[model samples]
Target: MKAPTNRRRAIAKALTALLPLAPYADMEKIRAEAGRAHLHNLPPTIAVWLAIIAHIRHAHTDYEKLLADGYDRDSARFFVIEQTNIVLTRWRATRFLDADDESE
Candidate 1:
């Protein structure tokens, strides 16, 4: 297969420019997930950011472990909000998640 088809390249480019601190493994997973999300025809920017957030949620925090250990999705997410925000800051994200704002 030809490497980095245009779609993959577009996602990768956006991620590299946006989340430059992301490790290689994280970037690869984000690129692949973003590529799949593009099938929904979301804009590249939307897809990239969505994938980035999902990666941080699943990889950087205990969100997934909580789910595996029997916490419901919402509760698991609640437990990890600050953790995700920390990773978000470490990655120099333009936006940070605010749990209180979402609590309403």
Candidate 2:
């Protein structure tokens, strides 16, 4: 596998620097869960940020209410999903050539 691009390194660095701000109830548990979820295949630093995002989103229950609101929920969820997809796609495209790439 190829080395990660400088941009990916920078993003991972920034994400690590911002981890203290994640609203995690128990960071260790979240990290453990992330590891258990088999995210170790990702670059260690990038995986940390992904885990943080996953934990934050998992802990946020407000989405349930939005989801129950029918049309409004559908629109909001669609917007969020699309935005997330775009961001992830861009990140992957500019960073690692493949999801299973082991190079950091």
Candidate 3:
């Protein structure tokens, strides 16, 4: 059979990267289970990753609205701080990946 598409592969790559390596963090396992959602066919991990991104996008919009509305200073600060850390983490993770480490 042919391999999955570039978009799907990129998704599996990214979600695998985002998730921690803790004992219970079995991304592959999650992928397998998610596959069961449809018999004989299932969405790729990348699809799930896309859904996750969508969820985060919604969260970000809500956060932005809160900040725009002059919500509590502490709450706004905390949201922005976390968002900043996430952005930086993703940037570093994808930015400086060694050529040898590019294999997935």
Candidate 4:
């Protein structure tokens, strides 16, 4: 079997850290939502990384910074913020459902 790439390793580490905060987080759901939001061609790992960075940096993260740092400006903006928004919205809805279930 081929070894995991560095990007995959980074994503795994990020997911490990995020799993504690969102134990019910569903990567498949996030990926699906990102695809629906027109991020279909974006790599799943890149999308996940963007989402993780968005969560970590919150409002402090800027798409322009990504562009300044040499990322494709439009793609970076869409994946980092727009696509992450779709995933986060789904995550929030899932959390609400879990809360509702617990309240019952």
lDDT leader: 1
Query: What are the C-alpha RMSDs, in order, of all predicted structures?
Result: 3.4, 10.7, 10.7, 13.8
RMSD in Å for model 4: 13.8
Best by TM-score: 1
- List, residue by residue over 1-104, the lDDT tens digit for candidate 2: 22246534544554545454433354555555445436646665666666554543334334454556654644444434434344344334222122233231
Compare candidates 1 and 3 on TM-score and give the better one: 1
What lDDT would candidate 4 get against the real structure? 0.43
* Full candidate order by lDDT, most accurate first: 1, 2, 3, 4
TM-score of each: 0.75, 0.42, 0.28, 0.27
Better-scoring candidate (TM-score), 1 or 2: 1
Weakest 10 consecutive residues of candidate 4 by summed lDDT: 95-104
Q: For each candidate, what is the lDDT?
A: 0.76, 0.46, 0.43, 0.43
Q: Candidate 3 residues 6-102, lDDT tens each?
A: 5446545655565444123345544443333331143455454433333333344355677679887446544454554464354342222122332
TM-score of 4: 0.27
Q: Alpha-carbon error at 72 in model 3, in Å?
A: 14
Backbone clash pairs for candidate 1 read none
